[model samples]
Target: MNYKPTLIFGRISIAISLLLIVSLLFIDCNSDRLADIKETEEILRKADASIQNSITQKNIDSLMSFYAEDACLLPTAEPKVEGKAAIKREWQHIFEIPDFNNKSTLTKIEISKDGSMAYTMGTYLATMQGEDGSPVEEPGKWVTVWEKQSDGHWLIVVDTYNTDIPPPDHK
Candidate 1:
């Protein structure tokens, strides 16, 4: 046997083996990442469901619980409301309105690679009684930023929403 040819073939085999191992490790890491993303997405979906349920029940306390202590609420036609207390007050005012009804449909949700943060974009339909007892509906879009807490729970850290329908009397 020619030692030169045997040595070259041995090196080639080792290189191929190393490449295969690396490829397998890369694939396994990616699979784990995908699983993490899916899990995060499910958690966010459940959270959204809780929010909807709270709104349906008009439970301001439960709804506010979804927000972080330092969360911010950017409402349309109003200044930004910062902190849990302010957000709770804002929701309380909305809940106090007679015939108030709101529904949110999540259009998209994205999670960070590290699973430390996420965001959801959705459309909202809100109905309330006007001053003359007339039913009014406002269609809008909203984006909420969520952060993973130390307790492994996700909470809304920032929320911003605006109406899609333009205001009346626009020239």
Candidate 2:
């Protein structure tokens, strides 16, 4: 047996194994960060879907449930509404409007690595039908800031929306 050559190859193999182990440890340490980011993204997606469904179903309470206590909203052609109660009132007012049919299309969703914060921007299409069944279409965009609470609940911290194009056939 060539003892010298065999011993040298064994030492090199052990060194490589040690390096690989250290590399895996580093990767494992950051795995939680990636998981946090993924969780945050999922939460935002669920909130978006909930809001869209709420709008479609005309469920005002469900629509506003994802808002934080101190959240703020900048609605089109209106003053900013702050706090959860005010936000709820705003939704109620919209829900009370006759012939309001709205749907959202999520165009983008981005989240932070810590999973503590995120923002989503998307387009909204609303059709308000007249008593005679004539539909008036409105297209707009919205951006929402979401924050993960201590209790693992995600809520909108800030919400803003604006109309990029006026309603069809408007004066």
Candidate 3:
């Protein structure tokens, strides 16, 4: 007599369980990716070094080579610079600044335990000539998220940074 309620409940539970299992099947467990953490980390570091060298030399083409096509730059006090083309334009403008110079030191490179993602944190010293022809140096911190592509290469996905000094509007 009471079997109807029990049967319905059992069916509902089974449906939910099946749904969860199917979802897991589609999820990226990353069990097969980045199995070699140390090697991957070293590769990432070398790629980052290439990026730094490009920046130091103000080489736009080389600098842009490390970014994903959909990469984004979260600049301070400005709208998000999105996509490869826009990001390239932004970097060009930055490189054109008077006496522009920058050096970034990566403090840490953390890879997810599951090897699904990696990111870097660092400090940068950016110097340029102010409107009054005076040297202005801004020491700042930055973080960059990286993603692995199907081609076995890592590329920058997101980059964000801000200076310690006050904003121009507040100054």
Candidate 4:
């Protein structure tokens, strides 16, 4: 007759063990999701800064560092430039534009919940140094798409832009 107490205790232990296993599984799943979210945000930040830095410095070579080998750029006014070489030429032409001396800023960087992709869309204000070296500011907007590489690096998959104000020649 003391067997009743032993049987009840064994059942309670088994129930508690099952609950612990489910709780652990849930926790592990949540942690993995959180890590993915963090990684996605980090990639977004890297892409945002890389593009702004490239434009501000007008460094075509440095700018290409962020691009994937097969990346492409679709300019607002011109045909799409596919591949790193074409993109480099595009940047070179941009740097040579009249009063091309300028700076830009980026904001509103966002990433998908799954963290596989991201984009940075923002306004840019650039100032051209006059022949007198005085600053002239021009503002525009840009959007860039980013992909996370298998090596854990983020690269620009697509780059595109549009100016808030048309080029002075157009006006």
Q: Please report the candidate that would top TM-score against the real structure.
A: 1
* TM of each candidate vs. truth: 0.95, 0.79, 0.76, 0.71
Give the C-alpha lDDT of model 4.
0.80
Model 2, residue 20: what's the lDDT? 100
Q: Given candidate 4, what's the lDDT at residue 6?
A: 98
Ranking by TM-score: 1, 2, 3, 4
**Pairs of colliding residues, candidate 1:** none
Q: What is the C-alpha RMSD of each candidate to the true structure, in Å?
A: 1.3, 4.3, 7.9, 4.5
- CA-RMSD of model 4: 4.5
Q: Who is ahead in TM-score, 1 or 3? A: 1
Residue pairs clashing, model 2: none
> Backbone clashes in each candidate structure, one number apiece?
0, 0, 0, 0
Residue 71 CA displacement from its true place in model 1, Å: 0.5
- In candidate 3, stretches whose alpha carbon ends up further than 4 angstroms from where it belongs are 1-35, 168-171
Candidate 4 global TM-score: 0.71
List candidate 1 segments past 4 Å from native.
169-171
Best candidate, lDDT: 1
lDDT, candidate 2, 73-142, per-residue tens: 9999999999999999998887876789888888888887666788999999888876677877778999
Cα error of candidate 3 at position 116, Å: 3.2
Decide which is better by lDDT, 2 or 4.
2
